[model samples]
Target: MKRLAGVGVGWRRQLAHTLDTMEGLGFVEVLAEHLDARGPLPEPLVRLRERGVPVVLHAVSLGLGSAEPPSPERLTWLARLAERLDAVCVSEHLAFVRAGGVESGHLLPLQRGEDALEVLAENVRAAEAALPVPLALENVASLFEWPQPSFSEARLLSGVLERTGAWVLLDVANLYANGLNLGTDTRAVLEAVPRERLAYVHVAGGVKHGGLYHDTHAHPVSTGALMLLEELVARLGPVPALLERDDAFPPPDVLVAELDAMRVALARGVARREAA
Candidate 1:
């Protein structure tokens, strides 16, 4: 598998022109559901590929953490997209989007227990077998967690990696939100993730609404999330990080500033590691 390096941004139609001419752009992640395998490739994306930039395919509806095995048709879509783009890897959330023939339209948290772990592992293995490239599971932020579980978030993630041999896509923003909303020990969870298996990092913006932090990609990246990202970089050493903006698109300069802030955080992390 090819290792992703430097800073990146999620590729959206709104940012196509900016991305096309943006300087020092390392790579871009595209939502897999937004594309059609049989259709013509987006011209800008093709241009990026021509420029030797890596494209990663990220899926949101795989429902890998569901009790049921991943849908074969969804797996096929992911596989075909990866092949179409020669993607560096395919990423999905560690949450279920649907259950019992009903769509939740949200990434619902999983129960942190032996049974849930087993089901997740089985689904992940199915996804791994179907994907053309390496699979990376991302930890999601949820408003509420199950009553009691046998495992912590880090332990559950470790269990999944051990069982499926998949990579980790650490989302710093999600971690920050989870910590704020669910009283999670953010630093402990960060320290527990296996550094060697980390594929990349996700940083996004969110807001505190109704006394809870919501991981909304529409806002500006928060200071707390940036700090968490720096901490992760300090531990892992120059891992690839990407800024994700899904809606309420900001101007190009603002987007560039966010990426710049991320780079600054990365630099701070490197300095801290060196000092240590």
Candidate 2:
């Protein structure tokens, strides 16, 4: 697969105009659940396609890491949307949002036990079988970690990629948040993940609430997260990264400037890599 260079943003209705006018955006990812696979694509998104920007379909409801099999209907919708948009790929969390028929209402981290790994591997294969394009698994940030897990987060993610032959959508902010909360080395997390399998990277903002840095994506990108992103680019050589701002929409100019900052960091990393 071609490495995605430059910065992208998660396509939001509120930022449509900003995204449309922005220069040098490498790609955008649209939330799959917001779209109807049977209907015509959103006009703005269609325009992006017309402008030659790659779109990736991102899903939150698949609950792929659940003990149960992935929802067939959700997978079908993702497949249809991907085919319709000619997306670069389809991605979902390596998390389970529901269990025993109960919805968690938020993405929940999975236990890194052997059983969980096997279950996740099976679900990933099931998803890949149904997806028209490649399925990439994203690592999520959590306030808590499973006790006495059989593998580290890096090992579990790499195992899933190995078992299913899928892609890794490494979220740098999530890695930083996890490090802050769990007290692990965030840089080690970045280094340990299988860089060759990385599909892209995600950068988002968060706030320190009650002593924990939340990966809320509702604030500006923190300095530490940007630094981690630079480290990732230094290791992987300028993989595609999208700034994810889900709420607290900033002014268009501010968002553009944030992207510009990321672009500069990415360029520095690539230049250093090339020089080395």
Candidate 3:
């Protein structure tokens, strides 16, 4: 598969016009749940494809970490959408959003034990078989952790990749949030994953509420997250990285500036790699 490179942003309806005219965008990730496979494609997205900008379908409802297998219908929808758009790949969180007929409405962390890892692997393989393109699993941010985790975050992520042969959608912002809230060693997590398996990176903003850092995509990209992005890029080389903003839509210039900041981080990483 052709790997995504350079800097990009999450494609939302609010940013369609901005992205359509934005220069040097490598690709855009669309939330799969927000689109209907049976309906006509959004004009801006179609235009993006026409311009040779790759589109990656990011699914939120797959619940790949649930004990139950992934829903065939949802997998089918993702496959259909991917084929329709000629997407680069299909990405989803390594999280469970529902269980036992109850929806959590949020991406929840999984138990990083052997049994849970086995279940996650099974679900990922099932989804991979159903999809037309490659699958990339993302690490999510969480406010809490399951007690007595058998595996560290790095070990669990490495295990998933080793077993499923799926790509890693490294979310630097999520890593930062986890580090702040749960005391995760961000660099350790980055060093554990094989650089070759990394598909892309996600950088977003969050705010510190009370005593915890929330991975709220509604805020500005934190400096800590950008630093992590730089570190990852330095280790992995020029992989595709994106800026994500889900709410409190900022002005076009602000988004562009954020993208520019990402570019600067990426450049610094590249320069450091060269120096080393």
Indicate the TM-score of model 2. Answer: 0.96
Across residues 16-130, which tens digit of lDDT does each residue of candidate 3 receive? Answer: 9999999899899999988989899999999999999988999999999999999998999999999998999999999999999899999999999999999999999999999
Error of 3 at 95 (Å): 0.7
Pairs clashing within candidate 3: none
Candidate 2 per-residue C-alpha lDDT over 1-276 given as tens digits, one digit per residue, 9 for 90 to 100: 545556899999999988888888899999998898998778899999999998989999999889999989888888989999998899899999999999999999999988899999999999999998888889899999888878788788768877888988989889889999987667666876677778888989999999999999999998888888877777778678899999999998899888887887788777778877
lDDT of 1 by residue, 1-276 (tens): 799999999999999999999989989999998999889989999999999989999999999988889999999988999999999999999999998999999999999999899999999999999998999999999999999878789888878988988999999999999999998888887886787788889999999989999999999999999999899878878879999999999999999999999999999999999888
Assess every candidate by TM-score. Answer: 0.98, 0.96, 0.99
* 2 versus 3: better TM-score goes to: 3
lDDT of 1 at 217: 98
Worst 10 residues of 1 by lDDT: 188-197
Tell how far residue 264 is off in model 3, in angstroms.
0.8
